[model samples]
Target: MNTIKNHIGINIFSKAILMMVLLYSFMTVSARNLKVESPNGKISVQVFNENNTENAKWFLKVNYFNDGKMAETISSIDLGLILSDGISFTDMKLLKSSKPLLIKENYTMPHGKSLQRHNTGNEVVFTFENKEKKKLDVIIRVYNDGMAFRYSLSGKGNFTVQDELTSYSINQETTRWAEKWNPANEGLYSSMVGEKIQQEEWCYPTLFQTKDNNCWFLLHESAVDGSYCGSKLSNKEDKNKYKITFPDPKDGRGKGESLPKISLPWKSPWRVIIIGNLNDIVASTLVDDVAPPSVIKNTDWIKPGAVSWNYWSSNHGTKDFKTVCEFADLAVAMDWPYTLLDWEWDSMGNGGNLEDALKYIHSKGIKPLMWYNSGGEHTWVSSTPKDRMLTHENRVEEFTKLKKLGVAGVKVDFFESEKQDMIQYYLDILEDAAQFEMMVYFHGCLVPRGWAKTYPNLMTYEAVRGAEWYNNGPEFTATAPVHNTILPFTRNVVGSMDYTPVTFTNSQFPHLTSYGHELALSVVFESALQHFADRPEGYYELPDEPKKFMREVPTSWDETQLLQGFPGKDVVMARRKNNVWYVGGINGENIEKNINIKFDFLDKHNKYKLRLIKDGKHDKQLVTDDSVIESADSVDVKVLRRGGFAAVIFSIIN
Candidate 1:
């Protein structure tokens, strides 16, 4: 009897102990084992998934926390590609995961660089196995402002991706700043609620606002240096769910296109979702952070400054080397760096002797930038006729010749597609141009997603409806104010833009605009190569003070700040270069509004001279007022009706 009782008691005690151990193990594994946070702990990210036996095993879900509150709930999404064939990244099981990695880097940016940034982040890799037990990995990185995730496939096999399996859910109402996916993505951006975004595809770097979180979110892809086709968001059956769509036979703009077959062991671009307050949304350097670093061993040759353009002004063209020299003279007088010889230079009837023109421009202490066609010279957007779309030996030949000719840069235009081939071609040119130690400008393409970081020689891109579009008609030019106001938060926030600003000539505008508005663009636009879209008369005829202001205002900046206003209504932006600050404001209202422009952005302890440039209250011309005042943080100013104002502040030396 004693033996029987002792044996039973021992068995029961052992079972109870085993159960407790198992329970403890499960809880430990589930308690946010895959977690990462930003340096300040202001942002937090957690990786999660569903593990039900009936469904796909590897459905990736992400949750984000801002300031200890949940900004995004477990959002059902996958950051993997599904091939056109039977192969898929789903039906997967966990293989292994890397311990969290801390990356802190500080790289000095050359001239025209912003911030000289110190990048800090946390990275982790999650590995999975397909149904056949083939392996793939997803990399997620968390920055102080946002987060990015990408897919990686390894092993020896060819795969053509049919699409990417990516989706995200918002925790707030769906008002988003939407730019409807136009093949030529040069269309203006408009705001719409989430439900309204159904069925319609919008281009990337898309912005979303959620009232619940009081935050802004921007979506885009980065580090896309030839691993996959370019992509945008899409949804068909459900408005609440959006997925990644690749180029199709029915692709708009890059119409009738098909994606390329990706080679083995390739990695995809980072699908980034940047979120923060307006400051984070505007100043977030996620794209630049995720991109490959500069490949050029010596970056001193990369120069970013103001450029004189022969296009965008009906009053200017490369009609002859003499006329071209006239533009070059303006660059010289303004102390600008380069003169762009645009498209018409290819026609002998319209100044085809570019080689001679380059020589003359160089002699005048200004380098030259010539234009070329891209994407097989497609003419759907009034592309240059039979212009050089160099590839293979031809591209090398032209580049070598141009390098020897002392060309400073090349402007490649009309990239009408986002197919893998088209995207790769852009990379090829960037690499080649870097090898020759010359800068390049991009036109007629989608907005840049941080390629400038990879190829530091790449200066600026014209992906916005700039001053050149004023030639279309009254309808286009009339919206200039509203358009300008919308850009700082939308297009310009993502990267630098060449809006070809400050057309001071009144006759140039068929619609209503003021010299104040013209002057404001000098401060508002963010082109590394600011194109002063004015004829010689535009500057030469201006008062000496105003001309000096245009010449001295910078194209690049050390910092930028948004003072006040909303999209399409009004905007006040403050930018700093060295010790000086420039403030610009624009309005789209029928009547003028009174607002306080702050000088508090300056050190509160400092005294400064503030120069105000605005429309005259009773006159057709512009006005200026100068005052030496101790910084009280702000001053009252008026933004004129239908246009805007500009001002500069310089510290007064004791």
Candidate 2:
């Protein structure tokens, strides 16, 4: 009887152990399942498995939330996954009922077939097979400010698997959309807090929409100080030969990459966005977030004002101490804060005397801003460097000496592109300059990411299509409207842009547009250090109405408004600083239209004075109105062809 009881116990114990092993295996498999979560909620991705093959099909949904409740549903789009290689498409379709509401046509490579060589090594052809699909993992996170998604693929797969011989292949595609979801719907439009709010009409995905293959991984945002999307190539061989390519003529002239090369294995893990209540703060914050904190150690170094220059407009033409000082005197007379002495004045390579020029500029009661170059082989007009070149290590030494010379700021140029090392170089320059209580302005640089907020010492960046290129050709004139219209929605959201506003006449091009257009830009664009690209003489040539407006214009603002219009079409922006409100509007082509100006932002009880800069019907010159009138509630004005308008609204102090 005892032996029989022992045998029964042994059988029960063995069965229990077997069950435990089976449960462990099940839990391990479940743990690897794909999932996505945001601050608001969780989404469990359903992975369809059939005959050892796994696939996923779902519609990505995004909603804008305010105070923990969904304010509006932003976008929803159907997404699918299928196994495909260079030749064959997998017949296995899991979700046939769902279809893409919007289909983007094939993107045309900008540089034609020549750009193919640029992609030679960097191509990541992900092959999806049963083994790899089973090991796939994905995680996506969305925030009020931005969104990020990451994917990891593992396991083995056979490529070109014939009857006997086989090779391996691998690649993956991740896509998301913003705004557009309902195909029949025209999209959401509303006015919020007296600012005209235009949500994206089409689904504007950030990183994946470039027409240039070389820029396939580059991400862009609509808001100037918003987030960016980027991708890094995974393969080692592709990484080494990675070069960016632009679109060539074979692609339709208008249909190609608008930007430059964005290499992978990016120095920074992801693109950034700067969020704030106002445009300048939003842009400044982005730059501060991406830049090293050392660059802006003390906020006191950053001083706000309009600046006059010798760099871009003069192009190192005014190297003489007498001539440069005369320009500084003009800046002082205008009540402009600082004057910049561009390249060729530095003694290290260009062999010009910096001390005399610095003394002369300071004597005029004006602060001087000098220019410097990164470690490039050529120094100041094709001259070779005498010292081992101005690298990051020695950047501080140069900055300290400039500080001793009483220089308030430096405009560093010719960085070319934002490589990992170059990104580090910019950070180092900002940090080292901060130690000397010096401000910085980057030219030929990437768009601002909000560094100004963190390191207020960094004033502005030149990333827009400014008046400096009017000399290029008539085509530039046509391109300017589109570029300017697009920048505010995209780049301006990032930080203060040194667009060098208010060029009355193009010295190089004889046929210039309306002077009022230039005056409007001063108010339309936001920058900490507003650069008037024209010569002092040029400002004098401008009509008194526009010129006076330029003199009164302020660079930084406490509040901003997108009064009307869309990207690449038209734009009207207004900014508020203290008790005054400055408004600007631009029409792309030679079209006459009436724009309604709303006074809803102002306190109803207070009376205000209105000053206007509008286009002259017969003269093609800007007409000014010093005539003060009490605001009844709102103002409606008519603007002329290729024309713009500016207004200053001030409270009538009792």
Candidate 3:
């Protein structure tokens, strides 16, 4: 009887030991490392999970390569969010990951950097669940030029997105260019080392150069519609670790909630990270790739072109009928498609009235663009045409009147918010403008987030410290040169920028850049309705070469290439419209240099006529020359300090 009892005890002890071992094995299996790679295998995203009884977390590691060799790694990126239900996903467990799926898209964007874009990539969806059994999905896309990820939540009822815990851990040794956070997004970009950056709110499209300077990345978001709030980056928690943050409660005149409140079955905008060299960053269409496809099927009415604007030279010019007609004549003279009648058109008087001005503009066979205040107390300037676009009813009424008058588009100004409500307001205006078959240009507004493709009528947006700043104060004079060079790598990458460029003369203050620099801007900057900032006299007085260049330069391009140079120092960019290529280069430093421009991108089988214009001995003079060249040829042109150049190359063999 004693032997039998001992045998039973031993059997029970073995069973207990087996159960414990099985539990340990199950926990260990839950921890996983999932990865997805770009098509060329040059970039990869590896997700690391730590799942245990004591600790559970999910983060991402982004790896980049150069010449098939590992160049750098964005070490750790924390990801998750919380809803109003008090359920935090910061410690959620990864349930499973889907196999890599292929994504291929071919689309056309007439107003973008490249008219024809191909979005090819691989995507993986990682599913996770919190303790409450609520599910969340993190969908990642890996493209040849970049990568993006977004959080998705699904259910039935409404929920407030209380917080987002997404953070990017950039290496402290990296170099970066970021602007201070502001609703208008009009600020200068400052280049600095990652560790030395101030712990402040930074705007989107923040640029980073790896510690080795072998790779580049631009951090921005896309597909931000009414359902979401626009975001900025903050490093206050830990400098060098930039975390996504929503708009300030003080923005939009302190009118709307900063934290987004929405219903279930929703997804956040893609947190886009475009990575590669300067050429890749300049030519990548990843922003438009992830954006929602066009909602307007009939795109026949949309046209991108250059415009003659009045505000830069004459602030109150729109109120004078004669001045409005003068700008209209300038548009016709320059072969521009449209002329803008800015501010106070409702009270036009001199020589005639607003009706007479519109009639005169139409008689010149040029379309007219009108401006209006965005309304509400968001702006201090009590500009006229206010309160006419606040509601959909008002927009329809106003747009209807403008449409009947044959207006080409409307420039809406003074939108000082990025909250969900303001975001919705922007969409509403776009929708209304499209309904009337009129294009839209947003000024005093937020930067583009792939909206131009979704709403093709969105001609351009003024979200940079553009030439208009020359009229505002003396600060622009000191910063404009470097600012111009940095924009091609930063702001202008994502979409069309209405910089109101090309001013050969002074506004309220003088520009320190040369005439060659001013001429280069007409090519360097891309805008659907490229606004010529100078007055009629400023452009009419230009020498034949510069005037002819401005008159013929196209606003939209079929292709774009970054030949050489660095941010805030200099840049040489080439843009192609059809078979002709327009090249623009700028020297941002305070000393002269020789910029070697290669014509290697041209058709090698054909000889071409190159009309080259460069800065002369003085900041105010320009020199022009013509030559026949082939793809193998290169020109070493001297560029003056705070100066630039522009060249037009077309096939001469034809």
Candidate 4:
């Protein structure tokens, strides 16, 4: 990043030559500027000192380049470390800089865009010395489509973090998408020019698109351990500028939500920016790529599949463990793996028969999962607040007990706090639950920041506005069609989401959308534990064709591709499990529009059959498909808008 010029020698004095060599050596020793590039060489990052004058107040600047062209030129965006004892690291002296190193590794995920991916990147490490003689390292890594930088602090005493001065400054005309930072991730996603963002607080991975270059920027944090509170962008006078803000301290350290008295030997979450086209935007796994590897010792017992849950059937005959056992019968009939036992199952009527129910269900080869509160989740049923499990000891005890009872997993719900302590505590729950080989699902919490990569037992997360919202009001259900279409590209792009799709015959939810649309959700939403929000009777009453279709939907896939459509509009997605290909498309708009399915992605020579399921013009659940093609060598179909369509292709000749 520093400018170096070469002067050809014609006639040189001995003293001048010695001075030139000494100056060059000094510049090399300072080494305040460095550059690192991605493996494919599409992304570039440069860090440099902005001052070189006498009595210099040295500050660092970062610049990003895309395809050998300047994309963002951020200046004087200095890092900081402020302590409660009035100590500041903003004016730290650079100690040493390591040479850029290459990193590449292949990891398999239980569920995601693809089963496995080879993550490649290059990283540079720089150590800085503060006035207190304390030291910290700043590590920057660049991937093919993104980059991340973080502060690695190490010490003995509890560090009181008064402030974190990291910053992001981009172009003025960039459009942005983010909600006002809140305790819960329940708000709608709205996009506008930076200036139009009326709320001062902003959600993470807030997306932006440059007005000129067509380059995109998605900003967020990765591997946010328990030592740090959750963060979002603070309001700025210039809409293009954003800074990190933490949640308010519960211990009353009230100078505005700061990371209070905590251990110093911890690394802050990696501040990341993913850049590329919309496809890259939708498919980026940069968050998981930077997180630590699997902490679970035994992943063999962990499995992913569709789950039967009876909590949505308010008026049905389903109740407590008996209802779950009934769902298990459905799971057995469908060949699904598990049935989710909702909260208060331990104390409700027939709850005492949990062991007996488990005995029969286990004999039938169906696993049972129980739900628990995440420390603060209250209940109207027999469960009091004391039933909440917050400590590591509590989790181990309960998980061990459940394991003895032959329970397959636990759904921990209602985590109301985003403080770092709670974040760390939640992770500890997963780590301890791993000892019993139990799958974990998080609910009533923040959007996943790639924790599933570290804790593979964490099968799915429910931070989105999921199916449970339907019981609240019709307004909640009305916007669901569009919400379902938008989530895949937005919330789901980061990790596996628990948007619990497929609702049919819920007496509480009378306003139905489309049967074809509900069927397509078997492909649209990607969750290891796909809990269809319907009772056993609802599934049993279905026609044999639809019943078989629901039973065969794969929870995890070997590959996925976003075929067409935009955010909050329409989406067409294609996924594969082994040799079988499943295509699903949903239209979020009110008007009818035809979507042309492309076949070039399929195998050209292999004979394939197509089974079409399209929305009927008359009723919501009618499978009136007038467009079924069998024994096809190719793939192509047209789906109607405000509705949906689905297809499965196999060897018709076979």
Q: Name the top lDDT candidate.
A: 3
> What do the candidate models score in CA lDDT, each in turn?
0.73, 0.49, 0.89, 0.72
Best by TM-score: 3
Off by over 4 Å in 2: 1-145, 148-268, 271-297, 311-313, 347-353, 377-389, 543-545, 618-620, 626-632
Candidate 3 at 190: error in angstroms? Answer: 1.1
What is the alpha-carbon lDDT of model 3 when measured against the actual structure? 0.89
Residue 557 in candidate 4, Cα distance off native in Å: 1.9
- Candidate 3 weakest lDDT stretch, 10 residues: 24-33
Candidate 4 lDDT at 312 equals 69
- Give per-residue CA lDDT, model 2, range 287-336, as digits (tens): 23333332344455567788887544556545666557657876876778
Model 3 TM-score?
0.96
Worst 10 residues of 4 by lDDT: 1-10
Ranking by lDDT: 3, 1, 4, 2
Better of 2 and 4 by TM-score: 4
Models sorted by TM-score, best on top: 3, 1, 4, 2
The parts of candidate 1 lying over 4 Å away from their true place are: 1-31, 50-70, 73-75, 111-115, 250-257, 349-352, 375-389, 506-509, 618-620, 629-631
Candidate 4 lDDT over residue span 1-654, tens digit each: 122222223234566888788666547746544677788776767655556421123344444556566655344455766777777777666667788888897888877667787778999887777777778788889888688888887777776888888877665577766666655576666777745655477776577777764577677788888777777787555566688877755322222235645676778888877777666766688888898988866677878999887776653323465676777898888888888777656554565355666787788888888787765332222342245466767777787788888998988876656776667767888888887788899877777777888998988888777777777667666788777777777777777788778876654556345677778888988888888878777788877767888889898888888878776788888889988888788887776666777666676655556677777663365463423243333334444455787777665454
Question: What TM-score do all the candidates reach, one by one?
Answer: 0.89, 0.64, 0.96, 0.86
Model 1 gets an lDDT of 0.73
| Candidate with better lDDT, 1 vs 3 | 3
lDDT of 3 by residue, 124-225 (tens): 998887888788899999999999999988887787889889999988888889999988999999888944677889987899998877889999999998
